[model samples]
Target: MEIVLYIAALVAAIGFLVLCVSLAMTLTSLKKTLNEVSGTMSGLEGQLQGVTRETTELLHKTNELASDIQSKSEKLNSVVDAVKNVGESVNGLNTSVRRITSSVANEVEKNEEKISQVIQWSNVVLEIRNKWKERKAIDEGRSGYSNFKD
Candidate 1:
């Protein structure tokens, strides 16, 4: 009975020691996993910082580009306004020209009969002048022939 009790005690001690060894091994493995997780977290933090800096720079550049575009758009608006003014001036000029042309056409229509009468008078005057020149030439020819005979 004494030997059996001693054997039982030794067995219990051996089981406890085995349990402690297993627990230690498990704890060591967990520690190594935690260290690896810590290293990975540090690398991720550094990458995140780099991304944040690049994002800030990009945001600044985008703002500058937007400002430049706004300025150019404002300048373009002035050019568009000038073009509109020119178009209005051209339209006014065209209207004036059309009015003048219509007035001239109306005046020409009103004077159509007078213009025809004037043309007829000018033709009659030209015919009279031609007849006088013919008479002068005939008289000169008769005088010249008489002097030649003499």
Candidate 2:
């Protein structure tokens, strides 16, 4: 009976020791997995920070571009206004030219009869001068006197 009791006690102690060794190995594996997970989380955090910085920079650039576009639009508006003013000035010049042309036409219309009368008067004066020259030559030939008599 003593020998049997001793053998049973030894077997229980060996089984207990094996159980403790297995538990220690499982705990070590769990700790290693947790450390790997923590390392991956730290890398993800760093990448997220980089993405955030890029997004902020992109926003700032977009704002600057928007401001540039707005300034250009304002300048374009001034150019449009200047073009409109030029068009108005051209319209006014066209009106003035048309008015001057009409005034010239009206004056020509009013003086058409006067211009014909003046042409008739010039013809009459030319005829009178021709007659006077003929009379003077006839009188001079009859007298037979030298143009310069002493």
Candidate 3:
């Protein structure tokens, strides 16, 4: 019976040694895998830093571009205001011209009969002057009296 116990204990010890060896092999494989993961993480961190820097630069450029656009827009607003003022001035000038034209047209319409009478009077005056000149020429003997007409 003692011999049987000794053999059993020896077999158990052997089994324990085998388990330790298997565990060691597994831990060694795990260590190698961890080292590879760490190296990959380092590379990923470097790429992330580069991306962050590029994003920051891009953001800064965007801000500058926006600022430039704002300045240009402000300058354009002044031009727009000037154009609006010019348009208003043109409208005022057109109104003034229209009023003057309307007043002149109204005055001409209101005095049409008077203008016609004045024209008739001028014709009568001219005829009288011509007759007087013919009479004088005849009396002075500057023209043949027989050639004079009434």
Candidate 4:
């Protein structure tokens, strides 16, 4: 009976030792996994910081570009306004020219008969001048022949 009690006590002690060893191994593996996770989190944090900085710079550049475009658009608007004014002035000039042309056409139409009578008088004067020249030439020829006869 004493030998059996001693054997039972030794077996219980061995089982406890085995449980402790297994617990220690499991704890060590869990520590290594935790360390790998910490390292990965640190790398991700650094990458996130870099991305934030680049995003900030890109946002600033985009704002500057927008401001420049707005300024140019304002200048372009002024140019467009000037072109519109020029078009209006040209339209006014065209209207004035049309009015003057219409007035001249109306005056010419009103004086159509007077213009025709003036043209007929000019032709009659030209015909009288031609007739006078022919008479002078005939008188000179007669005087020359009489002198030859004498």
Q: Which candidate is the best by TM-score?
A: 1
Off by over 4 Å in 1: 1-15, 117-150
Poorest stretch of ten by lDDT in candidate 2: 141-150
Clashing pairs in 1: none
Give candidate 3 regions above 4 Å deviation.
Answer: 113-150
Per-model TM against the reference:
0.66, 0.47, 0.63, 0.62
On TM-score, the stronger of 1 and 4 is 1
Score each candidate by Cα lDDT.
0.99, 0.95, 0.96, 0.98
- lDDT, model 3, position 125: 100
Q: Which has the better TM-score: candidate 1, or candidate 3?
A: 1
lDDT of 4: 0.98
Order by TM-score, highest first: 1, 3, 4, 2
Ranking by lDDT: 1, 4, 3, 2
For model 2 the local lDDT of residue 82 reads: 100
Minimum summed lDDT over a 10-residue window in model 1 is located at: 107-116
lDDT of 3: 0.96
lDDT of 3 by residue, 3-49 (tens): 99999999999999999999999999999999999999999999999
Give RMSD (Å) of candidate 1 vs. truth: 4.7
